[model samples]
Target: MSTTTTAVINLDVPGPTISRHVYGHFAEHLGRCIYGGFWVGEDSDIPNEGGIRLDVVEALRALSIPNLRWPGGCFADDYHWRDGVGPREDRPRMVNSHWGDVVEDNSFGTHEFMKLCELLGAEPYVNGNVGSGTVREMSEWVEYLTRGDDSPMASLRREHGQDEPWKVPFFGIGNEAWGCGGNMDAQHYASLARQYGTYVRNHGENQVYKIAAGANVDDYTWTETLMKALSCLGCSRTPNNFFQGLSLHYYTHTGPWEDKGDATSFTREEYYLTMKRAARIEELVRGHAAIMDCYDPERTVGLIVDEWGTWWNVEEGTNPGFLYQQNTLRDALVATVHFDVFHAFADRVAMANIAQTVNVLQAMILTDPDSGALVLTPTYHVFEMNTGHHDAQQLPVHLKGDLPTREVEGSALNLLSASASTKGDTALVSLSNLDAEGPRTVVLDLRGRAVSAFSARLLGASDIQAHNTPEVPDAVAPVLHTGIRTHALGLEVDLPAHSYVTVSLELAP
Candidate 1:
């Protein structure tokens, strides 16, 4: 039987403005995300701009990605920036122990990354190597990029090709410090965060927003201690270098991290459990944000979810270190749910990055090696459909209706997720249904605002496991949705099972 649900959108009630940075993407030095997936030799047959895949660059720019985090997850800590600069041939080769343990030729260096940011028109968020490096190394790296002054680093920059300084807005001190980044306790890491963050110089008008490594998953103690310690230290003198934002990393998994189920071969039961875990991010963000509020009531310290998205076993017969997997309809639903949660907490959550954007977990696009083919995944479709939310003011959604639930492990899981936003002359209402069966009838009330006209797009497939492949690139693309109905009271639409829909309304003139 088809289930009926309703939500009241109070357009008259204003809410927090959503930061476009919240929809940012991350590209680590892991797997095909860098080498063949995004970067190839300029002489290759594939179409590219200065060795970067042209298709990949255009595909990401279409989404209007606000920022791109670079260097590493754990890789950023071990990476020596000096080894990656200068002439490509003269650059040293290093073993990528965190990824595949393969030899990195250092072909794509600092110039290549900053160029990528320029191509995509995204702000560069570089993660400094704090775990295994000294403060001098971190400071010099900044000076090399930001200093127009004739410092040693800047002089070397002129020796290389580019003479101008590149602007770096977001700078992360470390990543996952509680585990991979030196495994220090909260107090110890807090001291390092303050000390290391102190030396990161801000040159010219480019003010660096220093983000500190935060909690892993539900480590509230880590959040509490870091906030408390930093708060006490700030009592004496307030410095912009010390932790402008606190980062949190959480990857949704079908099961435990050690045995995260296969990305492409998961059962319906496994999918339900994974959504349950993904939905838990609301609690994680809210809990951590509340702790920050205690220490920073004015919301000076922003909550940044820099590392997030689903992680699962890599494809069979592939390099395990590559972290390559297929993006399915389930991943699209997960992305929708996570975005809604971020929008719901827009007051505190300033920025977020879907981990490993191109070819890693929950990647937006996948590139095939044998055929040099590019395919946009289901998650990609979701992002494209909801691009209207960028830099838009959020409208509080007052959902008060009976929602269908799926029974999983003696629990009733809600099947619907939604968020709304307004920008310029239009409004966007995005909705998703996680139920594997039974379409949902969503009766929406856009109170206080009259809709002159409306259009919609839906991204879904018949099967939950439907995904894209190099051979079949258009497997799960967005289709024009004409299921919307306008009336005196509100608007109504049929949300298909295992689907995501976005309704763009033209406000009454």
Candidate 2:
């Protein structure tokens, strides 16, 4: 392979507006992500708030998580609201069947999840069961959570012990209807979405955001079908809206689910493929957004990428059905790059939640429930470091050189990824070098803005396989460097290979 290098000291491109929800995360009942990860039951010795672990709550609060999707990927479609309400002993118990086939006690229902969202100060985007649920079932769920008066569902909520409604505004019609949810075609699912969404009421103060199940990856036809169907509904001379947002799910993996690449060990080949998959999210969003444009020129409906993140084989000796994976510096770069790309298309991409928030897949925080110890993963650091990008205006940056590329299958991805935002007199630049080896010299020309000083916090590891364990917690943490000098036309910094760095520049007086 031939070596490649690129340099552009000062190039300007318009920054995209960043959405607050892009920093959102997901927690499903599928694994320890909920049972042992975020919720350990109030009776346990662990510190908790109404059964939710206090430590987990504090950690997530620190991330400023804006939204959290719950109940599941496939579990949502199988879920029945009635079974998760009323007395615990009376609440029905059903086999997860889709996940580990473990029996679910329905202890954590609508009330518990809404309360958890309140504690985290996040908007609760509940995935309503549509594939296997009747329209009345979903409509009652909306009424139960949002109705304030003595309506049938509101009476049931009061009878269940929670008198006040929980004001949940975002609702997903189903999850992955093309596969796990029901395996329905785009045209068929579109009609089903219209019927189910029609009855979801926005009771007082809550302007419900109903989201339809979207395409998996690059299935543009799904977006086309949804947008066309919704457009037809909008002009049907009816007084109701079918849906507000469309959802898409994508995971970065190298092989089939059964033979996914190792989480902690990989050759340069594997590293390249992972980043390549991560970079494809940009194209996926753009392609889907383009279809939405053709069918709905008014941009009436939004795009919600509610499920996305790395999906690898389970850790050694861990429950294979749990989908647990170790978090490494590679995961941090993936998070940073993915967030930057999402920010670039903020107008169309209204909200996105990482696949699993904790203890499963590419989690931000992991816990040792047995010991009650919490570990912040590399992905967590990336979120903490880039949190400044939340609600920040995306500033455009131009690049002129041919950077190195990582090849996968037959496609190649640029090794350098970057996003810039300016708030007040401070300009923040986030850059990621996805190459597996060798440092990349980045020439950031900040002549127009008059930068006085520059500093950065970088996250990298000696090897792509390096990860954080309970014993080696600092294996991959951000290293802060201060008092950087700027000379000539711009600033030049050596970005470590396979690293994510955030540079903050102070504007000259």
Candidate 3:
């Protein structure tokens, strides 16, 4: 016998339109994420478009990625833009001191990065060097990319190949000033953020959204201090000011950052622990948003969850600095939980970016060098399935019955997480069943709204540890879910265990 659960959802009562930027991805200078993972060189046998892997491009394009945060996580703060421009051969070689202790040839630089964004049709969110670079260097870097007229930086850009200025939508002033970006206290980083941001001027038609480096997990003092600093500058919950975004960095892990558990295989206890950690993001955002509310009640500045994703012990023999890990069904559920939280706070949580897009922690696409194989992770399918919710108006969803909890070892975990959105005549419902043992019945009360047609795709696995390997890339993939049924009040769908499912319905026949 199957138990029933009803969720009340009214499309007329909309909350906020989920910003497409919430679905952004990140690419860093760390590991093969930029080199072997994305760029394989023009002379290499790997299939590529202008040195970038064509297969990787096509895969990311499928997600309709809104924006891409690039250059670094820590690498961004120390990175000098000058070292990356000019001829590829003449570009100075340097040590990647931040990641892997490997040598960087400066092969893929500013122009190459911009070209990749052009290919993917994505907006580039460039991070300036604050810890190691000067204010002039930071200002010139922006000028080179966005300045339209004939100036020093603009002239240099033309000499480098880009004749016309490129429109840069988002610009992060620094990375983690609390730690990697700089070892500055809240007041110090706040001072530098304002000074550097002031000179980073708007060029041509490019209205760059300035993002200040924000807090780490549970660092309420940092958010409070930064907001207080900006508030002192007469920047408080208003449009057209010194700060447009404030970023926070957090990763989901069971233990300390050093011992984040395994990637592919794990105990049932670890599984529940992972979800428990995922829930911490809500606490972090709420606490930080509350601080922002105290400072900027108008909610002009966006709470940018710029860096987030699953972090685990590096694969068996992979370089620890590379931060590579396999994506499994558990990660898919983790991602849906994240999107659910972001959607719930869509009004103020303006944007978010997964840690690393290609080969780093919790990546969407995995690329193999030996076989030159390209595989889409289960998390990738979650993003693909939820693409409809992008820019869609978020609707209120009320669960009538309490969520069924399952005891894994000694941990009690709630079973379901969901969010609803509507775009014109179409309504999309995203559901996640975190239970690893049995299926879940989710009865949705559509509030007298009749659906003319309904369809869904589920990203699931029989085993929570199941993942895609190079040889069997299709081991876990999305399939059409057919458990949706209509009854008296509304409809109910049988969500399989360990699955992230998206339902699409057309209300008008």
Per-residue lDDT of model 1, residues 158-245, tens digit only: 8988799999999999888888888888889988988989888898877899999999988998988878756743354442347889
Write model 2 residue lDDT over 1-509, tens digit each, in one string: 32333333232343546888888888888878888988888798998988999888898888899999999889998999889888877988988878778898998888888889999999998989988998899999999999999999999999989988887879999899999899999999999999988988889888899999999899998888888776653353322378989998999988887797888888888888888888889989989998877666566567898888898888888777788888888888888878878877877888899988989899988888577788889999888888787887777665656577756778778888888776667778888888787777777766456776678888888888778877888898889854234546477666777888888877765
Q: If ranked by TM-score, best first, what sequence of candidates would result?
A: 1, 3, 2
**Model 2: worst 10 consecutive residues (lDDT sum):** 2-11
| List of clashing residue pairs for candidate 1 | none
For candidate 3, the 10 contiguous residues with the lowest summed lDDT are 232-241
Clashes in model 3: which pairs? none
lDDT of 3 at 305: 96
State which candidate, 1 or 2, has the greater lDDT. 1
- What residue pairs are clashing in model 2? 9-445, 13-396, 14-396, 15-394, 15-395, 15-396
Clashes of each: 0, 6, 0
Off by over 4 Å in 1: 232-241
Candidate lDDT values, in order: 0.87, 0.82, 0.87
